[model samples]
Every structure is written in C-alpha cells, then in structure tokens.
Target chain A: MSESQQHHQSPGSPPASGLGLALFWVYVLLYIGFMGLVLVRPDLLSLRPFFGVNLAIVYGMGLIAAAFVLAVAYMVLRSGR
Target chain B: MLHETSIAAVTIFATFVLGVIGLSFFLGRKGQSASGYYAAHGQIHWFVNGIAFAGDYLSAASFLGICGMIAFSGYDGFLYSIGFLAGWVVALFVIAEPIKALGKFTFADALDSRFNSRGIKLSVAISTLVVSVFYLIPQMVGAGSLIKPLLGLPHEAGVILVGVTVTLIVVTAGMVSTTWVQFIKGSLLVFFCGVLTVLILGRGLAVNAGREGSENLTPQIRTVRPDGTVLVDGQPQSRDHDLRPVGTIIRLPERFAGQESTGPLGPLAYLATLEDSTIVTWATKKHADSEGVHTTYTPVERPGTELLKPGGFFKGLASGNLPDRLDFVSLMLALFCGTASLPHILIRYYTVKDAAAARKSTVVGIAVIGVFYVLTLYLGLGAMTSGALDPTDTNMAAPLLAKTFNETLFAIISAIAFTTVLGTVSGLIMAGSGAVAHDLVENVCGVRMTDHEKIRCGKLAAVGLGMVAMVLGILFRNFNVSFLVGWAFNIAASANLPALVMLLFWPRTTRQGIVAAVTVGMLASLTWILLSADTFEKVYGLSRDLALTPFSQPALITIPLGFLTLVVVSLLTPAPASLRR
Candidate 1:
C-alpha cells in the first residue's frame, strides 16, 4: 500500500554487470550443448558405460550438478569482488 | 483417485490443512505495511526465501506432471526437470541482482523502474494476469486429483476445497504467510520424497509377475466404448469396471535371468539393470465407432533400452521429422525461458533485502531445486516399476506408488501433495493480486490509492482470482490434457522474456517497443496454441489434420517475433521525453 521508494541499489548503475553476463553465457552454452546432442546426435546422449550408467543419464545428472557448482562458484566470485 | 479412502489419509489431510491455515493467521499479523504485505518488507532471511522459491516453483506440474510423464515415458520426462532447473541459472545470474535492485513489489515495478511508462505497466500487468491464470488452472486441476483419493470427494469438491483454502490463506496474510508456507512445504516435500526414494531403492527392481490373481504376465486390453461403456478383453465389463490397473515387469535382464530379484542396486545401477529388463508399458488407441468413442488401452512389453530413449514420450524426436523436431526444441526453449519469465517467480525476488541476498537466495534455490529434480527421476522411475500404476490417470503415479509400499507412506505423500498444491496456489494468487492491485489498478489505471487501500484491493483481487481458478479447475477436471501447461510456458517466454531481456541488455528499446512486443508476443502464442493440432484433437474434438499451425509449440516463432517486434518498433519511433538516454 505504501508508495515510498525501497529499492536497494544505488540509482545510477544497472544490476546486470560483467560477471553476471559471463555466467549467463556459460549456462546458455551448456544448455545448447545438451539440446544439440538431443537434436543432432541423440545417440551421443545414450553413449554408455560411464560408472555403469548411460551417457544421457550421466549428462543429465551432470547438468544439474554443474549448475550447483557454478552457482557456488558465482558466490565465490561475488564474495571475492 | 487411484487409492482407497483410508482413515490415515483423512487424518493427515485434515491436520495438514488446519496447520497451514493456522500458520497463515499467525504470520498475517506483522505485514501491515504495503511493502510488508506485498514483499515481506524485504526482510525475509535469504535461506528461507531460497527454499520458498522451490515451494512456489514446484507446482503440481513439477511433482505430479513430470513424475507421471517419466513414469509413463522414460528419459524424456526428466528433460522437463532439466529445462526447469536450467531456468534458475538464468534467474540467478542475469535476472536476480538486477531484478532485486529494480523492483519494489511487483514484477512490473522492475520493468517500469527506469522508464516509468504507463504503457509498459499496462501490457506487463495484463500479461502477468493472463499467464498467472493459465498457470493456476493446472495447479487447481492437480488439487482436484490430490483430494479425490484422500477425502473420497468428487473432483469438483476437491477444486473448491483448494480454492477456498488458498483464498483464505492469501486474504489473511499476503506474502508474509505465503513465504513461510512455501518454505515449510518445500522442506517437507523434499524430505519426504527423499525418504520415499530410499524406500524404493531398498526394495530394488523386481519382475512383478502380476498381482496375485492376475498372474498372467501377458498384456490385457480394455476398450472404452463411445457410449462410455467399458469392454475388457472381448466382453463388456460389469458395472464396477476398473481399467485392470496396469504396469509390470514381464521379464528380467539376461544377467538376472534365473533370479526373481536383482537384490539391492545403487542409483545408477538401478537404471542400468532396468535397461536390460523387459517391462510392460501401456499404449492407447482411440477411434469413433457407431456414434460412440472407443478407446483401447493395450499393455505392450518393451526392452528397457527403448524406454530410456528421448523419443518414447516426445513423439517428435521419435518421429525423426524436421517440423516435429522443431516443436520439441521450441517446447524445451519455452521450459528453459519460462521460469525466469513467470510473474509468480519474478515477484519472489522482492522478498529478499538486496541484490546480494537475491543472488544468494537464487543460488540456494538452485541447489535445493537441483537436488529435488534429481530425486524426481528416482521417484518417477520407481513409480514406473512399482507395478501399481493407474493407466487411466498418470497424475496419480507418486502417491499411488507410495500406496504400493504402505498405507502410511501413501497418507503422508498425499498430505504433502495437498500442501504442495496449497503452497503453489497461494504464491500464484499473490502474484495475480499484485498484477491487479499494484500494477494495473495503481499504475496503469491511474488510480492512486493509499497503502491501506492497495491491500484492500489486492485481497479483493485474490478472492476474484481464486474464484476464477476454482471454476476452471472444476470445468477441466475430466480433461486428460497433461502437457497443456506447456501453453503457459510458451506464452510466458514469448511475451515476458523478450521485454525483460531487451530492457536489461538493449539500450534503445522504447516504451512503445516494450508494450508492443508484449502484446504481440502474448497474442501470437495464445492464438497459435488455440489453433494447434493438439488443441484440434484434444480440446476442440475435431480432426487434428484440420489444424492451422505447422506444429503445436509457438516459441520458435513467437520468441523471435517478440525481439524483432521490439527492434523494429524501437527503430521507427522516437523516444519519449522521459526515456531519452
């Protein structure tokens, strides 16, 4: 109900910065690689025997794990900055 | 609808609903300020806000739909999970901090933060409401499915129960209660699903010859007549005809040829072993006969290797045709782009204190959500082989899978699923209300109300949206359109994503461009879906061949249209005095 300003950022600079853009591109590429496999060479996704699991499952699980790790990496980068 | 009505289910359902309502009232006391009412005064802990992200995001579609999809189709079902989780990456990195830095209450706040365009407010607000409504229907429909088993109530009654309860929760507390409810529901859902997954792994994979009297491993065929009469094998079934509840392992892998069970297997081992087994999956055929609709469900046995392939469910990938392939890619694109574009999810950013908190919360959310998605693969596959699947209703897979284990697990799972509906529905209603009160009424309509007046209007909007959801839920109850939610994603991506991405990255985007892009993008996707072949066959009850569109999904066309519209419109029009940089 209140109309008062409560925005957190200093007014001048936008929030989408260099590091954020880098991370976004990284994720976009990873996703593209996965989807490309599904499209151009789906058989590649099914390529198997890594830890007794097929390549598709491993890759799928890897994407999830990698997202987590990358996010954690973002936190590290942000903190360091 | 898949389980027997038991005392435990009733007790658990009642207790959980009461507890949630109580929590709403308890949390409702503190958020009297406008920011407090809408965004929790940006005071919520980063961690709780993070988990609440999961609660808000994991709607019935995620829990029931994806699980059911995977249970029926194989590796493809998990693709939805990956697409869903991947969207969080965009949210975390690109949208999170900027969104947090920009908006005060609603998603529109951020978009209009720099430009202060009434046109932007009007278009974005309307888009928000439309997407929220489309998204709400599935949640309410899912609510009906959850309640039908626990209370032995009709589907309409279930929809009304959830509508009334969610409305009460939102009207009582606003975002304050919504956040806490989501956090609790999210934690409990993950915790319990993990427990269930453990139970599944412990049981291991076994070739269920058949349940007791149904020892014949061969498939059973049931034909549903146009007059809605049921025929089993070659004879009409008695009045109490059940679809012979199908799904079982017809044969084990060669490695376990003699053994009835493969003992205990690890997560990867379970999938590997199943790949070598032969399982009975159901196939359905529908045709018109004597002015009656006859649909046949035939169970077919297939090797695990085939089931694990992508084409099994998506059809497009399996067809190996170009247009079909494009449709599959478009759907994946929608799922990927849609999360960052959803109004309910976008509004969640305002709950945190600052850009840093918003970023941290998203990271936490991704971690929590990522782990949960992985769990869904196990849950879905476990249900697939649980041998207790209801071929008629895939949405019942998870709880029914619990039923196969024990009554207690079923009771707990059903109760959590009900809360799951409540958690998601509340968040959605909140987003809808904000679209109306804060964005539409206050900003676009030029109605300047005080904070107190705004809260009153938001509550009114919540009640109205709740009523709309209830009606749609009841109307769509018998509708077996599971992937219809893809419509919401497609529209959200095409309409909202273009404006947000351009606003953040492109410098010359005019207010007119933003407004036009949203309007055209939204209408384009909606019209395409309405004219799609799937809609012709499933929704309109007409021949699919008569459809207007080349394929069902519109993202591959409309997403680019949005960006292009913005570009062309921006170039032709001069910037408004307020917008010149």
Candidate 2:
C-alpha cells in the first residue's frame, strides 16, 4: 500500500491480517447472532430480569466481551507485526 | 417569575457571544477559501476534532433534556446515554474511514462517489436539508428554552439571539469558527457537568423539607362528578377540586447494593401522587368560555428519610417490566445509533484530515461523551430529590438542583447552555449550507462557481438556514424539544445510515440505488411522522387515534426498510469497474 493509503486506513480501519479478518468476521457474526437472539427470544439469553439484564443487555455485554477477547488475543499472537 | 434575566447571566451570555464573534474574525483569514470555509482545510487536530465532536453532539438534548428525563424517569434516562455512545461504534468501526476517503464537502459526495449522477446529488441534498432542518428545530427551540430560564427573556428573543449570533459565527468563518465554538462549548459543558456531579456526590442526598416561609397547611382536594358539582364518593362535597388530595410526601433513599455507591448519603427520594402525576390530562373545558380554567396540580413531597435510598424511578426501571424496559432500550438505541448517523455529525469528518484522524477523533469524542453521560446520571438523580423541580418545567431540574447549592454555579451552567445552542446550531447551519452550496447550487444546478463563489454562497445559505431555524425555534416553543430531536435522529439514522454504509461496503451499490434509498428513507420517515397520531394531535389539532401509524416513533420499521431498499436496488444495478474496487 502507498504511504497515503496506509495513513487513510490506520486506526479503526477494517481488519487486514488473515487472523484479524477471521476474528472480525467472527465478531460480526456474533453481533448479528446475538442481536437476532435478543429480538426473537429475549428470555432464552438469561434469567436475570430484575437487574435490567434482558436479551439486549446480554447481547450488548456479549459484544463488549467478544471485542475485549479479540483485542487481547491480537496483542498476544501478533506482537511482531 | 423566572430568575433568568439576572445581570450575571446577561453579562456571561454577552461575553460568550462576543468571544465567539471575535474568534470568527480571527479565524476568518483561514476560512477565505471554499475548502477552508467548509472543511477547515482538513487540518484540525484529531483530539481537537474529537472534543469538537462532543461539542457538536451534546446539544440541549444532552445537557437539559436527558438530565430532565433522568431526574423524572430514573434509569430510563441513562438508557439515552448508552444508546448515544453506542452509535459511535458504527462511526468508528463502519463509517469513519470510508466517509473520509470518499466524501469531500457533504454526505452526498460519499454516496455519489461511484457514479457522477445528478439524480443522486439532488436526492441526497434534499435529504440532508430535511434532516438538518428537523435537527435545527430542536437546537433552536432549545436555545429559546434556555434563554427563557437563563436570560429571563422571551422565547422569541432567545431564538433570535441564538439565530443572529450563530449566523454571524457561520457566515464569518464557516466551519472553522463552528468547529472551535463547538470545541469550547463541548469542553465547558463536560467540565461544568463534572463539577456539578462532584458537588452532588459531596453534598450527598438530603430531604429538602418543603419551603420554610409558607404557612404549613394540609393540601385540600375534592372529587367532582361528571357534572359541575364537586362530589366525594357518592355525595357532593364542598371543596375546590374533585379528587381528594394526598398530603403526605413519598420518600426514596439511595441504596448501595454493591461497592459502587460512595457519594454522601442522606435522605433522597422522588415524590408524586400515583394517578394525578402519572396521568397527563387534557382539559375537557370548552373554548371561548367567559372564564377559562387553568391547569391545577397537587404537590408530591419527598420525606427527609428517603433521600438516602434509591427507589422511585430507578426502582420502576429496574423492576424489569416490558413496556418500561422497552421504552428505555428503544430510546437508548436511538441515542447510540443516532449520533453516528446524524447529518451534522457526518459533516464534521470532512473538517478533519484523513480517515485515520477521523477514527481517532471518534474514539476521543466517545471517551469525552461517555464520561459526560456518566455525569448526567449523577446530576439527574441528585436533582430528582433536590426539591427544586418546577412542576411546569422538568428541564430546569438540573440547573435548579445546582441553585440549591450556589447561585454562581447556576449562572455558569445557564450561560454554558446558551453557548451550547450556538455551538450545535452553528454546526447544523454549516451542514445545511453545505447541502445548499455543494449539492444544490453546484452539482444539481450545474453552476460552475469558483471556490470563492462557493464560500460566498455557503455563507448566504448559512444565514438562510439560520433564519429558518429561528422561525422554527419560535414556532415549536411548546413542544417537547428533546422528543422532537428523537424524531430527527430516527430520520437521520434511517435516511443516511443505509446509503452511506452500502456505498462503502457494496461496490454494486449504484448511484440510482443510493438516491432511491435516501429519498425513500427520508420521505418515508418524514411523511410517517407528519401523518402519525402525535403530529395530528399536536400540530394539526386532530384526534391522535385517527392517525395512521400504530405508534409515534418510526425507527424500528423505517430503518430496516431503508437498508432493504438499498440492498435490493443495488442488486439490480451494475457498477463501472473503475468505480468498483
């Protein structure tokens, strides 16, 4: 990639590495899946209703967790890059 | 009646306005070119732009509306905070890079990148104008609203004040001034809100034992039958009102279940009569009657003991009921998704250099915005039981809560609120100006204007948009300004999000598809709202039940329809190879 193009795509750019791409696509799928689950069957996700933890909460938390996990994994495996 | 016209408030407001104009003149030299005027030469620092984002994003809705909503509704209001921040995820992860790479002046540039189609330009421009105008109303109305309570001026005066000041700001230096103004407002708002939150925490919760000077007497209520005669139970009762008044105050204490609650703790609570408070009544009294009856109300007081425990609105929200929870979740979703897709917000990306800066700025913006939202929760809860709520106006809850502490804090916050209008409206007018100059005058009309001419035309458009916004500010004086903003978000998320997302990700997304989606999304949402029951009742003076849509909000349906239209239309169209990656 040219220097200008590289600058344009840095920071919050879509995943480019094979592993990164795989992880990104997985995260996307998880997001979609959990969202669908929330919309379709909110009760199946969790039993904690009193504390405001319903399907959307579960999915929201799940996505955050997944993102955290991916960030950690990327740091561990792709340090040299 | 209102303490808005104090010398301190007027002086602070005047100083802020003069400062904004001075800044514009200082920045005017740099904004001489179309590029500089409209896009700030794409050289604004990422961190600065990020804070500017907060400034631009946190309008009256964030400072006043959300705080008010939270003060009244508890955890439900915090839902708006989460939803608004969540929308940035889309901005960071999905939009920033592509929008930076593809667009030049306006969102239309990004949508029409693949094909140089006039149809796309015209359609997107119209959508931009529609969203900008809808968005403008709230900010202008907020300006007027704040002025009434802050400067002790008429609502019209506030609207005019903001309109003139912001037009000068925009016309003088365009985006450069708008960005800086927003940056300053954004920083001040966050800082002040932080101080208020700390104050609330330090003071802890205390029962504002009702007013001291008033002669203490039990409130009186009388039940009236369908006839003019007042009745209690089955018999006619000699009293002023029909219903029996409940005199005792309800108390809610702040509760710390886990480790998180560390603030000063005393009695804290929300007090409201069940039926009287919950039911929003419309007068059955006839028009043109010799003597007109005004709105009457019973007061609900909070006991000194409940100030330390968390119940009331929070308890109801945490009760996990479906309707309450859904209302909370849906509102949050709107706030979260709404920020990224807002037309005024999208234009800010153009004012920064490169996609990288845009993304980085969004991260920083989110951090600032997120922290402010956290502060809103504290501010709202603190105000809930501060015993300063105006039964007529909930928006004053937070500022009034500050007043309970000290007058200086009130003056500063109220002035900041006024500048908040200037900052957000300047940004809105800039977006509208871009739509008019770049999309309509240049591309759609085929006018070959020089960069100099374009900047001139943009300033003119800014003035025009500002005037229109001022009129709307006065007209929509009575409507819930925050609720109106929600409709704007729905329209923006529906109209702009699908087209922008599809254009970036799907190479097959033709110009025709882009135009169709935006036009449909904008029109569908706009028309739906116009014909909806809320508008029919509020705007058109008709029965709300006679309206078309089952509910007032259109996000759940129209947003998906927009995405669907984009996908389906894109599938049928072919793209040129060069335009495609």
Of the candidates shown, which would achieve the greatest lDDT relative to the real structure?
1
lDDT of 2 by residue, B1-581 (tens): 23535677677777877887899889888898998988999989988999999999888877887787766654446555555655666666667666777778898887776678999999888888988899888788777777776777788998999999999999999888889999999999999998887777676533222333322233323333344554333344433323322122132223422322234532121111111112111111222222321233445443322221222333324364554444334444455456667778998988887765776677678677767876776787667655565544556667777777777787788778878888998998999899999999999999999989999999899989989999988898766566778888888888888887676656567677888888888888888788876799878878977898765667766777888998888777776455555
DockQ of each: 0.48, 0.13
Best by DockQ: 1
What digit string (tens of lDDT, one per residue) describes model 1 on residues B280-305? 88887766666455556677888888
Clashes of each: 4, 28
Q: Could you tell me how far off, in angstroms, the CA of residue B351 lies in candidate 1 after the best superposition?
A: 0.8
TM-score of 2: 0.80
Against the reference, the lDDT scores of all candidates come to 0.85, 0.68
Best by TM-score: 1
